[model samples]
Target chain A: MDREEIRVAVLRIEGTNCEEETATSFRNLGVEAEIVHLKQFYSDMIRFEDQRSIFDYHCIVFPGGFSAGDYVRAGAIFSARVKSVLRKDLEEFIKYNYPILGICNGFQILAELGALPGFDEDRPISDRPEMALAINDSGRFECRQTLLRVESRKCVFTKEIEKDKLQIPVAHAEGKVVFPRGREEEYLEKLKENEQLVFRYVDDKGNYSGYPWNPNGSFYNIAGICNVTHTVLGLMPHPERVTFDYRKNSFGDGYYIFKSVISYLEKI
Target chain B: MITFLFCEKLIVFMIADVHIELKEGVADPEGESTLKALRLLGYKRVKKVSSVRVFRIEIDTKSKEEAEKEIKEICERLLANPVIHRYRINWIG
Candidate 1:
């Protein structure tokens, strides 16, 4: 596929606040990216010209935000709406190996949709969620620059970040990644074996630490993860927020994620 | 017996109060903070506090058992995150 033909959709719905910056991140990489409202994809009330098809884009993104007010659990409403309406389209999208990225509340939506911790490679979408991003242990919204150690090179989104660690900002009250109580070890082992684990929260020294360093007290200090195919990714950090190179002493670590996806889309 | 048969013919409305709470081992900062606030207010007897989300769903079904089952399905599928939270259903008709 030609790079000019690559189209990315930064999908959004009511209360989703980060679609603009996320779309801009892809646009910065010289690709066409649009902030597409979820309503435009499924709502009958939307104007005919405003409606969109998931098949039109090569990449889809669920940007961070408190969608539908984050009521009935964070991302529950958004996830349910998508699953109720766009499940087949999304499932087909995944089966086709198109890239899907989720950040913060977007991550929560993916978990709710059972699109991450994808243990069954044959089934790109799970019938039920296997994990969750629960409330932070701190009991309050945590907004800070968190250090993340890149743990997997197999993910298409992180192939360009050769560095062992990245400093990305996270702002959420529900970013703690947790698995089912008794299945933690088994899940971690499988994730490690499949090389699906993408990032782990680490301290400034790149060591797994506790409290504020680990932010939400995520299980095993996990910050991000991808599917077995490495095509679908969900993370609690906002990569788009730090993709600018003009910032002081900026490494623009997040820019590489967009670049990596663009490269993958170009190759296939 | 006649009244009971007639009652069955009438539409029955029920409200299911579903309460969802984080599992015992999961950390709950909101509940903990509320506990701390109570402690600071000199409620020395308070030991622990946990938070739960309550969802009241209205259903129209003739059989209470059927209503319960449907509400349970809703709770399991969408009302709660089974991974970290457990939900209980209480029906009031």
Candidate 2:
């Protein structure tokens, strides 16, 4: 028996459209990946009233898409549903140290659920119960292949890239990660120190500075961030869409993210 | 004829768009539409919304002195992006 086989579960809800690409990416990297629809946990289809425990899987993914049709704000409606309905299961899964990735809409959901940094780990919930992914600095949706500098060395998804920068594609309108007042530099500094600041917007030369080179105009050119534990990561880029050789834009390296995950699983 | 009343002059709401700009190369059509929607929503009373991102701030400061200082810091640090987005302050007590 091949114990080295890694099992990953790509979660699919009604509006989710990236599971196939994400699954394909994982499969191409020699990991056993499966697309599990949210309906499977519940016998009914109309409402997301049913969802089972997610402890069976080693890795879970919340792929990109306009989940819940971006109603009541992007990812807000769907994330509320998930947090309220599957709260216990998700909490348990995290307690066990399971790996989770939220891309785009998924990132929105994670932040809304207080599951990204789980600020409670450091501060009381009363201080700030709600988090926000504000409108882009450009005041618009940015869609194109852009360069991202891998700044964090502690995350599970980005460890294998090793390189200081990665050229990945991004498609989003509300990709800004904003916290309360007076918390910008401190939050970024903490993320940097924790190695949770995984990806940053950069230029062709891998310099993380200036406009046009940095899309969305994230603070400190931030593109992605992970939780304190590194088991959970939330990013603005769509790695699943460009995880194959043919999908690469002008730059041709997108498989390393999946490769890194698989490599970690193999070692385990 | 419309009747107008004057008193000690209470501060009325002043609409301010806390514009946030993406990097020069970044694209943002949604932000454009939002500006359009603001116009369609009958916000024409104000001169030139200019399609910038807007954030509503509610604070209690009896004096304009304290209000200006607090709001400026808020916008500079969190409410607006200093690098890409420039903020215009409007005092509404």
Give the whole-model CA lDDT for all candidates, comma-separated.
Answer: 0.89, 0.67
lDDT per residue, candidate 2, B1-93, as tens digits? Answer: 122233654443333334444434323445556667887898876543333555666554444566667777766444443323456665433
For candidate 1, lDDT tens digit of each residue in A1-268? 7888899999888999999999989987788998999889988999998899999999999999999999888998899989889989998899889999999999999999998888776777787788999889988899999999999888999987888998899999999999999889999999999999999999888889998999998999999999999999999999999997685766487887888899999999
Calculate candidate 1's fnat: 0.66
Task: Report how far residue A158 has shifted in candidate 1, in Å.
Answer: 0.6
Lowest-sum lDDT 10-residue window in model 1 chain A:
A244-253
Cα deviation in Å at residue A56, candidate 2? 2.0
How far residue A228's Cα lies from its native spot in candidate 1, in Å, is: 0.8
**Candidate with best TM-score:** 1
Cα DockQ of the candidate 2 complex: 0.06
List candidate 2 segments past 4 Å from native.
Answer: A1-5, A42-52, A119-130, A247-252, B1-45, B48-93
Q: Per-residue error at A104 for model 2, in Å?
A: 1.5
Interface RMSD values for all candidates: 0.9, 8.9
**Leading candidate by DockQ:** 1
lDDT of 1 at B87: 86
